[model samples]
Target: MILLGERQILKVVRFATIGAYLGDEDDQVLLPKKYVPSTLCIDDEIDVFIYRDSKDRLVATTEKPKLTLGTIALLKVSQITDIGAFMDWGLEKDLLLPFREQTIKVEEGNEYMVGLYIDKSDRLCATMHTYEILSGESPYDVDDMVEGMIYSIKKDVGIFVAVDRRYHGMLPISEALRIYKRGDMIKARVVEKDEEGKLKLSLRLKPLEQIDKDSYTILKEIEKQGGFLALNDSSEPDEIRKQLSMSKKSFKKGLGRLLREEKVELKEDGISLKKL
Candidate 1:
């Protein structure tokens, strides 16, 4: 069946003006021009990412992918141009890594492990900077630890993380329990590898207990001020960050424990110490 908004392995049924068409039970699908590789041929068993075009039309692409729609893989750069660099992702066409998305200018033949995703423009793209994704790698199962560094953050998706600099991970807004800025050095645990091989990391691991403790101190002050501390979850996440210097999740976790233990009470007005 022709599944929409999903990637599927389909056999090329025939060639079309735009590119090859993969045969679905009902109709032939277009694989588009820029996405086709020069070597693709009819009857070739190929993996195609199927998604709706601007007009909500079903479309496919053979561009180098960072990871299959729900799978992850390391890819290598094939060439770089003024507009962007291309990576040989085992597809008909090299995947584009636009210059603007680059953390650092890439040289031809250079390799970077990047998370692959279809951008707003419905194009395949990559990035070397993935910090938030890596942060969610924590709370991992026994013996599920991996190492990588913070690469970048820009106020979206919490943080883009890189695992071992080869795997892409995401620390979604809900999971980022601490305040993390770009380039902050962090060690995270791999909690789970999604079907796409994207990792979930955690910075709230036992190893960071010391930092968590420090965060607790700040929470104490917020509590003393009453359950309605001036600290807004939306305040300058960085300025107020100077006091706790931890992710919002971590800060809240520490505070939540204190409240649960009756050590403090948070009110709509402010946070306050629980009376003995």
Candidate 2:
């Protein structure tokens, strides 16, 4: 059977004006002349990725698309037509992004994260609505370091992530140390599994590692501010958060490390670089 949206090693059975008809016994797909290997001949096998063309006809190409069936990726909008937008998926035929599949208003020359799916018409198309298509279960376990793309951010909720572009994961606001926007690929550690089996993620480094990083940051800030900064353990939580983008608890922990190492001297009003 011919597999659409997949690469298959098909045998060349016959020739045509446009290309060579490649298949086994029961099925054949056209391998366009441009994609036909110069040394290819009848009964010889060649690898080709198959998909429907603009006319919805089954066609084969030597070029591989960035995304395939049941896969999600960040694709660029190549053009916009009356029917829908076309995404350049590194294939001869731009993948279709129909109006109904668009989650937001898309325009030409911008990139959008989308998923590929076969529609009721048995044609492959791209859709911006990917959350529903992402799987909730994953093979990853707690504390496993994983990477994912940020899909959506919600106020007071968290940033929704599509792990491996398939599994569902989220990085909560409390764990976010820096600002992250949609479409950014981030590396995070799995903190726990949610009720639905989706992953709860943490972008912060491991405790000891974070302390080391924070200590370095505090020392650098103090030096940058003329060898002293008006920030100390007694500083307001909001002020610490505003300056460091970290919780007061974390700032205190980092400050303690710096003080213990004699790297900085803490005073009533601020901290200063220790003179060696």
* TM-score to true structure, per model: 0.37, 0.77
C-alpha-based local distance difference test score of model 2: 0.87
**What is the per-residue lDDT of model 2 for residues 193-233, given as tens digits with 9 covering 90 to 100?**
87788999987678999899888888888888999889987
Clash count, one per candidate: 50, 0
Q: Give Cα-based local distance difference scores for all models.
A: 0.62, 0.87
Best by TM-score: 2
Model 2: residue 148 alpha-carbon error in angstroms: 1.2
Instruction: List pairs with backbone clashes in candidate 2.
Output: none
Off by over 4 Å in 2: 1-3, 6-49, 55-66, 220-227, 236-243
* Candidate 1 TM-score over all chains jointly: 0.37
Q: Write the per-residue lDDT of candidate 1 for residues 98-185, one digit (tens) a residue.
A: 8877877777886665656567866656655433223333333533666654555657665665555445655656555466664444
Model 1 residue 2 CA deviation (Å) reads 5.5
